[model samples]
Each structure stands twice: as structure tokens, then as C-alpha cells.
Target chain A: MSLAPDEVRNIAHLARLAIGDEDVPAHADNLSRILELVDQMQQVDTKGVEPMAHPLEGGQRLRPDEVIEEDQREAFQKLAPQTEVGLYLVPKVIE
Target chain B: MFEHTVAELSRLLADGEVTSEALTREYLDRIERLDSRFNSFVTVTGEPALEAARAADAERRAGRAGPLTGIPMAHKDIFCTRGVRTACGSKMLDSFVSPYDAGVVERLQSAGMVMLGKLNMDEFAMGSSNETSFYGPVANPWDEKAIPGGSSGGSAAALAARLTPAATGTDTGGSIRQPAAMCGVTGIKPTYGRVSRWGMVAFASSLDQGGPMARTAEDCAILLGAMAGFDERDSTSVQREVPDYTVGLGQSLEGLRIGLPREYFAEGLDDAVARVIDEAVAEYKRLGAEIKEISLPNTHLAVPAYYVVAPAEASSNLSRFDGVRYGHRCEDPQDLEDLYKRSRGEGFGDEVKRRIMIGTYALSAGYFDAYYLKAQQIRRLIADDFARAFEEVDVIMGPTAPNVAFDRGEKKDDPVAMYLSDIYTLSVNLAGLPGMSVPAGFKGDRPVGLQIIGNYFDEGRLLNVAHQFQQATDWHTRAPENIA
Candidate 1:
């Protein structure tokens, strides 16, 4: 179950990484080796074994829905790379 | 005084043998003399430390000081400390000053421990060695040429160099223990949910655990006492009562069944590491502990499983950093896509970006079942292996790493080799169990660690065992003569 170079390139694209064409072979090789290592999982009979998302099992712990404190957006936003008043600045999404 | 444990310092402070100001000054002076070489601290807060010291003195004068009062400690940069620049070791959060305190920071402050500064770590706590830190690598106190094991490398180095009596560290995959082992210090990653993760910058949610790093197991136990508790803020915070970790330190180890996993010693282990761990087990036998060989057949799958699960979680957790409400944003965005791309590309390091991509791919729609689902099942088998072993033994022991701390660039180019260094440590996190590293002996000039694996919330026993070992051996007490 080795990963193909194109598969690695596709995964890289999905991950939003700008991998160069030259680096594709190395990344493909590494990813394929990792996938090969993971191939060992197929030998285990996990058909009846339920997938464990987290180690602990219980109802989701929730806090009070109501706000217990005031907003610190003004102060926090000052640390952001770009912000204006309360709005976070980004490149315009639409024309 | 510089070599004294946190427990010793606290006692002297309470008895008026030393003032908080003097203690702070001593530590500050040591940090000043040594930090240049160690590179342990990213930001050393002089004004804040002195102010807290004075307040600690006043608190003592008012007879309101707790055990940790007036004692100095530092935080790993991952904790969002109020008014402090809590950079999670990336250029992204380099200028970000946290508006609020992490739950651990708040709790430690309540205990009256003075904040020294923020220690260095792997960028976003992603790497095993602290080299990935944006600020630079933290040097091992034992030998400046060698790395202090990381992502809590700075904390471990600082403690070893006597920069601070103790410091806080987070372990995802042996981050705390590896560095502790390399620097010849003691640190423990408590059972998951033992310490609140609120205000902690999430790396891998299921694996990230905050714990104590210090000069001794006793110091670690005391710090853990203050750090572990229920917090409504952290959803994963356990509702179980926090035990006094120091209560059973004096308990005997007679009749204790110590399990040595056969798989851990099977292959790829260095001779020096194997020898030191064998010596540690012999000492345990001398302490009346019964030793037996156990098998965790699923151990090899841990690293691969962790790579999948951790990256998947990291990819999701880091999605919040997309030119967001705080942290690095693109200078000028031609479009929203450009903003995200440049911001992330510019902000994160090569390794962090690599992990994010790996995680993103693993969790992508078509591959999710084959990659993420399969990893989760393997994660269960890894955990179940521990469950079966624990039923037969009180605790497990193994070499913390396959080899001693390597040269700076030894495994940097080889990501697989670097990943394999964590083979022994990853299974513990996969199983969500508690583990600690105590200084066993040296491999050449570099220090080796004897890892003790405990059942859930068995921190007290683990600490006691390490403490007992420290008492019997001087390895924990030995410091590099060149330091300070």
C-alpha cells in the first residue's frame, strides 16, 4: 500500500502546502514508507473492535452556555497581525 | 542553595531563613550567568519576577504563604500566561501577549509560586528536540554541545543548570521525559485529565498533558499537587478528587511487582542505555521489588498510530490559526485564500507545516477511514496491551530512548530516525497512562534515563520510586561543573 507520487501531491494540495515539483519524490517516498508501516494494522482483526476516539468514555462535559465574562477582543486583537476595530482584516473574499 | 530542591527552598522560605527577594535574586543571577549558554529561556521577566517576589514576602509576613509561596518557577511558552508573551515557540505567536492566564498558571499563582519567565520549547511543541524552536535550541546543561531533550527542553535545561528550582512542561510524546532524561533531571507527565489543559495551546488534544519538571521527584510531586485539580474550563478535566501526591512518598516498595516489557528490550536499544536500565532494575530488586518480564506486543504500532492521530488533531487545532482573531496574519491579502496561504506559510516552520499536511491528508474524506480509523483501532490495541500488563505488574520500566542525546544535526535530516527515538515513550501517551524519567546513569558523557510507567494516576508511587532511587544514587544530584 505504498503512496503514489501523485497521491502525495494530492495530499499536499489538500493540506494547503505549496510543495515544489522537485520535493514531490522525497515526500512521496517518506509518505509511502509511513503508509507501509501502517500496513501492519491490516493483520489485526479489528472488525468487532470499536474505534476509540478518546481514551476516556463518558458524556461530553459541557459548561454553562451563558457568557460569564466580558469580551477582551479589543486587547486581544491588538496582538493579531492585522485587525481593524473589532473586525479581523483579511483579503477581500469577493469582488 | 542553588542545588537545593524546591521542597528545601520552600521550607527555608517559610522558616524565614531566606526571603523571597533573595531567592529570586539568586535564581536571577544564576539565569543571567548561565542562560546565554543554555538558551533555555525565551523571555526572562525581571520586573515581574521581582514584583511577585515582593508580594510573596508580604504574603509570608501576613502568614498566608502556601508551600510553593516565594518559590520561583517558569512556564513552557505553550501556556497562555496573562500579560506575558506566551509564544508557543513559533514566529506566529512571537509578539502575542496572552490576555488571560492558563488554568495551571492561575493555580500555581494561587499557591503563591513566583513566575520566573517563559521557557523555550519545540515550535508549537511539535518536535522531540528543542531545535525547532523559533528562538533557537536549548543546550543541555550537562554538555552545551548536546541538546536538552524537548519540547520542554528549556525547562529541563533550566532546572539542570539551576536557573530555576522547577518549571512546568507539557508532554505530547515524551516531550517532558526525554528532555528530563537528557538533562539529568526529574519530570512526570501525569495521567491525562490529572492536570487541566485549559489555556494550554493545544497540540494533539488527546495526547497533550501538562506536568511538573524539576530537580527532584519530590519537587515534581509538590508541583503536581498544585497543578492537578478539576477545572470546569477544560472539558477533559477529571471530576475525580485530586490526591496529595506527596502522601505516600515514604511508602516501602517491598513486594512491588516491577514489569520489564520484553519488547522494549528486544532490539535497536543502545548497550549503554540497556546497561543503565538493567542497573536501575537491580537497584529496584535490592529495594525488595520483584521483577518479571511482560510483553506489550502492540508497542511497535504506537509511533505510527501517534503520527496519524496527533497530526490529525494538530491539523484541526491549528485551523484556528488561519490569519485569525490573534497570532500572525498576512501583511496584505489579495484575497482570502492568499491570506490563509501566506499567513500559514509565513508563520509556521517546516516541521509544523509538514505535520499539518500529514494530518490534513490523513483526515481527508477518502483517506479518513483507511488512515484515521485504522490508526484509532491500533491506538486501542496499544492501550489494551498496557491494561493487560498492569494487571500483572504494579509498574513498567524501560529505557526512555533508544540512545542518548545525539549531536545537534544527527537525525535532523532523517525524520523517520527522529520519529523512532520516541518509540518507547509514544505508547504511554497512546494508552493515556502516566510516566516519568529519572536519571539512571550516563552513556559516555551524555545522561540516560530509566523510564517508569505507572497505571492511571499512580504518580505518587512513580515519584516515590524515583525519589527512592535518587536517595540511593547520586546521579540526580550530579551537575555539570561547567554550569554556573
Candidate 2:
């Protein structure tokens, strides 16, 4: 039930996080303790128990798919770390 | 000026006894002078606050003022305030200025409440002790070395220090109530959808709720009235009429059914905290409430279940912060993956990263069913326990935290011990019930709070119950004597 250092590293990669080598042991130890805590779920007989995703016991209200507002791309993009001509710029994804 | 409740200040402003400009100046001065010791305010908007106050005065002269008109309130940095940096206490957002107001901020502004400024919080509302802030930890005003329970520590600490008469806070797991408990203030987290979450940054969306924090339940009511309502922008916003939370303040507690959950009073609760809570119950009994012993058997599962569900949701919600759009970006990235990985790694703190990794692992291949699904099932069981208890008792009562505030750095190195700080308060988030902490009494110099739990949309009754209790005790009025 405990996560090994490699397993922890794998999870971090999946999460798109870079854990320093010096920090991995502590992360591994803490994550393992938490997993041990999560293991307590095995004792409960949750047969057919519904997985409650939200506290509200109702379905999400859907709105009609129509343009109902003005565009604010420029305003929104102002907070981006790098942007050009109203487009968000990231490190080049394709060579 | 700082000592008066929001209601009292409103009355003075309405009666022409105090000018909004004068009142705002006094509080701003207090914050400037005392906040260094408190560390409660992350950003203090003096010029805008004074400007807003003058506008309020003009509104009053023009006969256009409302109850909260001219009142100065602190906002937890989680809510987006247009033209201000809403950091959410994380370096990732250190440079991000919001373009729009959060739903709560917009409503409160329209009601004429002026913003004192944004208060600090645990980074991304992820930690309990407020130690994870990119801004340093907020000191408990009661005892400087003591920790103010968080992630709404700034809001609660400010209230305790009287830096702001009214403040806004969010609760996901025990963020609102735990700090209120530790700092001797009143805070209420209404039913999940009672308040709009549109612009309040998401952290475990299902459990996160924005609410009011202040010196008294009545102040909480006045703030909550303006804060809670349905919004078209928040998909989960309930289609229900927002009640006037103030109207129910004088209701009689006679024949009120109070449930004392057996599991809550069991092992692990601090002896002094339990004694303080018992004294509050005795006062409630004196007020003619009938108490019965009840149990939420799945209560033990709440901590583990919340750790799983919240982190999983946070991992998904926080993915939007990946270097490209808003927030921090890494320097000289060689590749896209490196950009994202380094930005996130350097941007988030230790606790936040730990949760993200755990959540990523829990939802990863070969583990989703065993962790995420299982935790959700436990969530259902926890909610069922509350539902069954509510069918019998009108309201539930317990200690808000296992103990009063611990020293800063005492449990910081021990994450599991730190996580247990919210043991008594997390179940309410799990069930989406309305819960609050009212100043009950003192365990020595530090304050202890009585946690009041009510069923869904029971915010009015919860405030009324606390209001009744406050009328009988002066605990909420008790400030940090050691500070001054």
C-alpha cells in the first residue's frame, strides 16, 4: 500500500511536477502514511454504495448553448505569463 | 471603532453619528498600526477604502444607503477582486491581477460594503495551519507563538485582533470554522450551493464554500445575507431564494432539539476543549434546549475520505495553472513539459505538492477504483449518517476543533497530525451541511468555540442559535488582552 520512491516519481511525472531528489524521500514517506490512512476504507462494507461526487444530491443544471455574452479575450489574456496579439504563448510543443 | 460589530457601525452611520470616512480612517489607522504584530492582512487597500467610504457618505447624504453601506470588510485572498492581486497565498499567482470581481465581492460591493483589503490564506486553501502561504504564516493574536487555525487564518485572526470588523472567508474541509474556533470569532459556511462560487478560486469544488466571518453571529448574519444567493455563473448555484439571515436572530430556543453526537465527544477530543463545549451546552440547556445523544458512525472516515476527494478535485482544478495562461511561468524552459513541471514545482509549496502527487496517484491507472471510488462511497456513508441524525434532532453540536490553537511549527513538520486539526469540522463539508463556530469560552488565554451543525439550508437557524448564545455570553467580545 506504500508508494516507493520510483512509484512516487512516476506519480509526480503524471502530475507534471518536478520533485527534487532531496525532497522525494520525505514525499514518499508522507504519501505512504496517507495511503495507509486511505487503506482504512477496506474495512467498510460499501457494497453497492453510490459514489457521491458532490454534496448536493441533485444533477448539475445545464444552460442552453448560445452566445450570451461579449468576448473578453484581451482582458482575460492580460494575466497570462506570455501572450501575443490576444493569444496565450507557451513553450513550443512541436519541434 | 475596531471593537464595534458591523451592525453597530451600520446603525451609527445611519444615525449620522459617525461619518463613513471617519470610520474607515479609524479602522485603516488601526490596521496600519497593529497589523505588523498580527500579520493578518496580506494587502491593505487604504486609498480605495477611503474612496469607497466617501462614496458611501455621499450615498447616505443622497438617501441611498443600505445596511452594509460604508462598512469596511476584509476579504480572504481566494476571491477575485478586480484590479487587485488575488494570490490565494501561492507564488503561482503572485503576479496575477484579477480582471473581474468574485460573485461575493460584487454583491457585497453593491450592498455598499467597502473592502479593507485581501487577507492571507493557506496557499490555494490547501493547508490547515496557514503555514503554507507564500506570504508567511499569520500569527494568532491571542498568543504570537500559537498558530491560527486555517486556511482562513487571516480572516479569523484579523477578527480576533479587531483589525477588521467584518471579513469574508471560505471553508473547504474546516477552513472557515476551525480558524473561527481557534481565534474566538463567529463564522458560518452555508450549504454548498447557497453562495455563488463563480469567481472564488476553486479548491475541491464540491467541498469549497465561501461564507462570512466576524466578531458576532449577528455580524455574520448581516454579511451572509448579502453573500448568499443563486448566480447564473456558478453551475452548482442552487435555485432557491436567499433568506434574510438577520430576521431569525430573536427566535426562541424553547423546545429546540439539540443532538450531541456520541462519536464527536469520544476519544481524541482535548479535555479542556470538551469542558468548554460542555459549559456552552449547559447554557443552551438553560436557554431551554433539549439535548439528546446521537452518533454519526462514519465520522471516523471523514478525514481520510476528504483527503482523497479534495486532493483529487484540486489536482484537476489546478491543472489550469500550467505556465501557458495565467500565473507563474518557469524561466528559460527548454521544452513544454519542463515548463509545466518546473513552474508547478517551484510555484506550489510542500503540502500542496504532496496532495497533488497523492491525488494524481489515487486517480492514476490501476488505482482509481481502490482510492477515488472508495472514498466517494465513504462520502455517501458520511452524508447518510448526518441525514439519519437530522431526522431525529433539529441541530447537532460539537467542538469545532479537537483542541484549541497549537503553537506555530509544533505540528508543521508532522502532516498527519496537522491534518487532524479539522477532524471535528470536516464531516459538515462532506455532507454539504451548514455549520458554524461561535465563541463559547476560554481554555486559559486561548478561545474555544462551540460548533453548531444544521441540515442543508439551515443557515438561518444556525445563526439564530448562535445569536441566542452570544446574547447570554460575552465570549465573542473577548479580544486578545495580551496584544494591547
Candidate 3:
């Protein structure tokens, strides 16, 4: 029911969030309490109960295979942090 | 004008007694003067609202105005508004201006409703209190020291303060109903897909639903008619016809079977709030409703189940907020990983970061079954409990929150304590049923909301029930003193 500091660090990494060394203890404490709260669910007998994903009872609706959306590269790219030549700019991945 | 309801204003506009431009100006001026104390609005569209109001007046001159034409309203900051800043009450989106209008905004605009501005909310629609908002907490109009329940806190407070006659809100586990109750207003969260979520920012996509908040159920009914419908853009949008919510407002509640879940009345409920709920039930009985004691045995598991499920979904949805595309970006990055991490870390508030971490841990390898899967299975049990209760009753009634609004920072340090405030309201969201909160009475100076829960897509009946109660009671009519 408790999260260790290393575990919190791992979670932050997996979530792609940067947490400073000072904030880890607070996060570990909060996450631990939340886990303890959610830990109450373990007491219930859910042996054969199905896991509910979507609330409604139906599969996703599939649209016909046709191009319907107009290209708005310029309009959408206007809101991006960084972009160049119709591509979102980011730290270089290639060596 | 400040005391008038949306229905009343609509009538005035229809009668040619007042122009939409003048009405819009009065509301904008009131918000400018009074909203500093409440911090309800994030952005005020003064110039654009005037233009829209002028257009509405032109439409009326052309003899082509609908019931809601020329009525001024505000949207929760979560909805995307073209050319307007839609912050979603987060530092991450503080500067983000959307390129297109949300489905709800588009519908309301087409109905001839003028937009006043966007209201504030908890960051990414998380948190029970409005304190988590980067823009600052919304003050409860009834008691300026207390918190307005959130993430629809701004909408509720704005209505309570008479700053706006109508405002849109979203509910992901009691966001709409709780705030409405705390602020002593009326709000409804329609069936999960009753209103389209095409451009509404996703927090927990499965549970997040948009609805209307106003001073009276009749007003909510009017706004709901314009806001609810199917949109192909949202895969989860329900395809059923949206009945005229206003038409059923006059339906008699005679012989209505009302259920009171035993669990909801037990344990942590405040005694004063319980008294208010009891009085409300008696009023319903006088209206010829038959009250029955029902058992939703899995009620206690809602908070735990929600913590796991909502955060798990939010973690996946919010991953799109990296530095590369849109949202906040860090100063410098040695690598792509650093960019994403620092940008997200600096952009998100403490509560948001906490949820992402919890979600990451829950969905991480090796722990998925014990946490995520178990939570989902429990969610089924919770929903099944409601299904059984609804079989014996037409609607369920209870307190919207455990207690009235608490002072800001009272439960801020303890997340579980804050989560428990929503215990009585969360189960309805889990079941994807329509739920509403109406001003039942007051606890001392603060307000108490009586929650009404209905079966799937039963929004019309729910609105009727709230509307009938509003007809008999003056609680919904009472506003905070000095608000004008």
C-alpha cells in the first residue's frame, strides 16, 4: 500500500515527467496514501466479475472508409511549440 | 436583470422589452465589477459578446428568433473556443488558444446564445475543490470563505453571484452537481453521452460529461435542450433523440417511486445536510412521490474504484501534452526525453502530477491486474448496484455532497479526505446515468443540495422532477446577500 522513493522515480520516468529530488518525498507520500485508499478495493470478492471499460453496452461505431477531413496543417501548427516544414520540431532523435 | 432567470430573460427578449446588446453589456459589466471576489471567469469576451448580441438583435428584427436567442451564457474553460483562450484551469494551457469550437459551444452559438466568456475550473477537470485551479480558487457566493465545489466551481459560483444567467459545466465524478449544490444553484449531468464531447478536453473520457448550470431547473432544461445531441466526431456520443427537456418540466410527479440508498445516509454525512435532504424528501412525498429504502451494497467502493480508473485514463489522455506539439515547453533540452519530462513537470500542478504518477504506477507492468483490473471489476459491481436500485424506483435521491463547502485548504493536504466529499455523487457517474443537484435547503449559512439520480437517458424525467421541486420551494430563488 506504500510506494518507495525509487518506485516513485520510476513512475515519473514512465510518465515522462521530471520531478526534482526534493519533490519525490512528497509525491511518494501522496501516492502512498492514494494507493492505501485504492487498496480498500482488494477486500471485495471480485472473482468472476467482468471488468467494465466503457459504461454503455455497444462497440465503437465505424464510419465509412472515405476521406472527410480537410487538411489544416497551417491552422493547427499555429498552436504548436515548435514546427518546421509541416513537421513538429523536437530534440533530434537521429545520431 | 441580475435577478432574472434564463427563462425570464428569454421571455423579455421575445417581448421586445430589452435588447440582447443591453442585457449582454449589463452582465459583462457586473462580471467586471463583482467577479474579482469570486474569480469565476478566466476570460471575458466583451467585444465579441457585443457583436454576437447585435447579431441576435438583428435576427429578432428579422422575426427569426428562437426561445434561447440572444441569451448570454458562459462556457467552462475545458471546451475549445475558436480564437479564444481555453485554459482548462491549468498552467499547461494558459496560453493555448483553440483553433475550433467545441461541439457544445457550436450548438449553443447556433441556437443564438451569446457567449460572455470562459469560466475557470480545476486543472484538467481533476480535484473535488476548486483550489487545484492554477487561476486560483473560486469563492463560494454564499460564504466567501468556503470553497465552491469543482471542477465546475466557476460555473456554479458565477450563477450564484448572478454574474451569468447560464453557464456550461462538465461532470467527471460530481463536478457539476457538487458545485451546484455548494453554490446553491441548479445543475444537471445528463446521461454520459447525452451531450457531445467532441472538443471538450478529456480528463477521464468515459466519465466526463457536459451539462448546464443555472439558477433554476427550468433554466437548466432550456440550456440542456440546446446543448444535448449526437455528434459523429465523438465516437461515444449517444444516437438517441434528445427530447425537448422543457416540455416535461410541467409533468406531474404523482406516484413517482423515489429510492433512498441506505448507505448514502449512513456514516460520514453531515447531520445538517441530512436534515435538509430529509426535508426535501418529505416535500417530494407531499408531491405524491412514494419513497422507498433501497440498498446499493457496493456504494462504499465508488471512491476507490474511481481513483484508479479516472487517473489511468487521464494518464493516457494527457500524454499528448509533451513539449513537441502543443502546450508548455521547457527552456532547453539535451534530448527528447528531457524535453517531455521537464515540460510536463513544470507545466502541471502538484495534484495533476500526483494523478499521473498514480496512474503510471497502476498501469505499469506487473501491477496492472492488482490495481487497474481490480478497480474495473469493482466498477461493474458499483454500476450493477444502481441497476438493481433503479428496478424498484424511478429516481434515487440523496445529498449531493457529504457536507456543505469547507474552507479553502481545509482538506487540501489530505487527498483522501477531499475525495470522500464526493462519495454520495460518484456512483451515478460510474453507472453513466443522468444526475442532478437542486437547492434543497441551507445548513446554517451554507447551502445543501439534494441529488436526484435517474436511469439511463432519462434526462427529461430528471429535469421534470427538479423542476417540480423548484416550483414548490423558494431555495433556488434565494441568492447571496450583497451579490448585486
Query: Considering every candidate listed, which one attains the maximal DockQ?
Result: 3
State the lDDT of candidate 2 residue by residue for A53-74, as single tens digits. Answer: 9888777788899999899888
Candidate 1: TM-score, chain B only = 0.99
CAPRI-style quality class for the chain A–B interface of candidate 1: medium
Backbone clashes for every candidate come to 0, 0, 0
Provide the lowest-lDDT 10-residue window in model 2 chain B.
B475-484
Better of 1 and 2 by TM-score: 2
lDDT per residue, candidate 3, B331-408, as tens digits? 988899999999999999999999988888889999999999999999899999998888899999999999999999
The whole-model C-alpha lDDT of candidate 3 against the native structure comes to: 0.94
Q: Indicate the TM-score of model 1.
A: 0.97
Quote model 2's TM-score. 0.99
Docking class of 3: high
Model 3 chain B: worst 10 consecutive residues (lDDT sum)? B323-332
DockQ ranking, high to low: 3, 2, 1
Those runs of model 1 whose alpha carbons end farther than 4 Å from true positions after fitting are A1-9, A19-26
